[model samples]
Target: MVDFYPLARKAEVLHVPMEVYLMFRAAGGPDILGQSAAVSLLDWFELDTEIIIVMERPSPSMDLVTYSTLHYPLPEDTVRDIMRQLVLAVIDLHNKRVFHRDLKSNNVLIQETEDGIRVRIISFGCGCIVSTIPYTSFTGCLSCAPPELFLERKYMDSPTSVWQIGGVAYELFNEDSKFFNTYEWFIDALGMKTSITASEEGKHFIQVCLEESPSKRISLEELERHPWFFTTT
Candidate 1:
């Protein structure tokens, strides 16, 4: 059995076999109500582990450290499996009318099961309800953030998670940051200066996910049916 006592003392303990922990801002607790709501939906579908809120602690100051060394290239089939799991998880969250707000590689946890790789979306500290007050500012990792998020605009309703997921997929496959690199040369190598393109199928899928117009972006349900995912053999 996984020893969760360390986590239990730090956060509220949910009654689940798997060890899960959640910590939220004391004053901003209501802002993250969507996470609890999403967790409920996952429980209904039997797809999420129970999350218990640990007691609030003073937010810690941390330094930014690039995770360039944490790369392990997986087989193509394994990558597809990870993507499938991520899509299913996101689909379930969208169906429940909750947006993750922050979706990045660090926020996602991967474990190997007897059947295959099991991916779990974690960290709901910044999540908010779909209908909550429109956010005027964005708060997330800049590397994986959508371009629109950087713009100073109120009432951003884009399904930004989709774009972040694509960034995650790119990182998984490349073992290096494509768009999220800090070095100027690395960013240039991504061919951002020119109109870089991928396969027809890849282009279609990535375009929808990275759509500049929030209204034009594809929904999770529609994304699950995209050829990039379905056509994978």
Candidate 2:
């Protein structure tokens, strides 16, 4: 995939946001290349007014959104596998000091393999590095945005990511895409609202992800060890 970023928007800095972002990744280390969950960056160059980025194209792949829309309410085992991969990816990113602030179904590429399905996280436009300090600015889909980000505009990398992951999991399992319908459905889901239901395991998992208190939210490590993945057997 080739992405073009116009530098004219932020003429003062004269640096393309994406170009700078890629530069950081390039400097961060070569570990990204080994991460199965992230889309690999191939090459990037700067033009007069645009930054061109070349990335690996995952052939015969569709985004998770399309996949889910076509195959909503995916089987429990399928969802478990998907979450396992995603959690593994997030763990890798966190370990590498990269935070994908904008993780949603739209940018997650999905391709079927001989063994199973593969998922790659894309769209680093809203991503940043992990820091001891909290981030104040937020990006990505409002529906997938965590409550802490919306309410306080301040969020930590790990907890916020947990929320999105949980939201995606719930959406896939329930075949409901109104993740951002915070006014009604989301509010209910957070409350474990009786009207909006899921499997007992599903509900427990979602609750852990959507915990209102960021500090109490499930960590990537904890999620990886969750019982949900073991249920498939």
Best by TM-score: 2
Looking at model 2, report the run of 10 residues with the lowest lDDT sum. 1-10
- Give the Cα error of residue 198 in candidate 2, in Å: 4.4
Worst 10 residues of 1 by lDDT: 56-65
Which digits, one per residue and each the tens of the lDDT, describe model 2 over residues 1-233? 42433333224433445534533452332345524667776666667776666666676789987897888656777777788898888888788677887777787788787767998777777777788898888766766777887778798889988988987776676534554343344446544344334567766787798777888899888988887777753
Query: Model 1, range 1-233, lDDT digits (tens) per residue?
Result: 23232223236654432212222211124334333212221221123454444422211211111222333445445555666677777766655444666776666655444654456555565655455456766665656656555553543433677776666655555534344332332346446423333345655665577665667888777878877766653
Cα-based lDDT at residue 172, candidate 1: 54
Q: Which regions of candidate 1 deviate over 4 angstroms?
A: 1-71, 155-158, 175-200
Which candidate gets the maximum lDDT versus the true structure?
A: 2
Clashing pairs in 1: 11-54, 12-53, 12-54
Off by over 4 Å in 2: 1-35, 181-186, 190-198
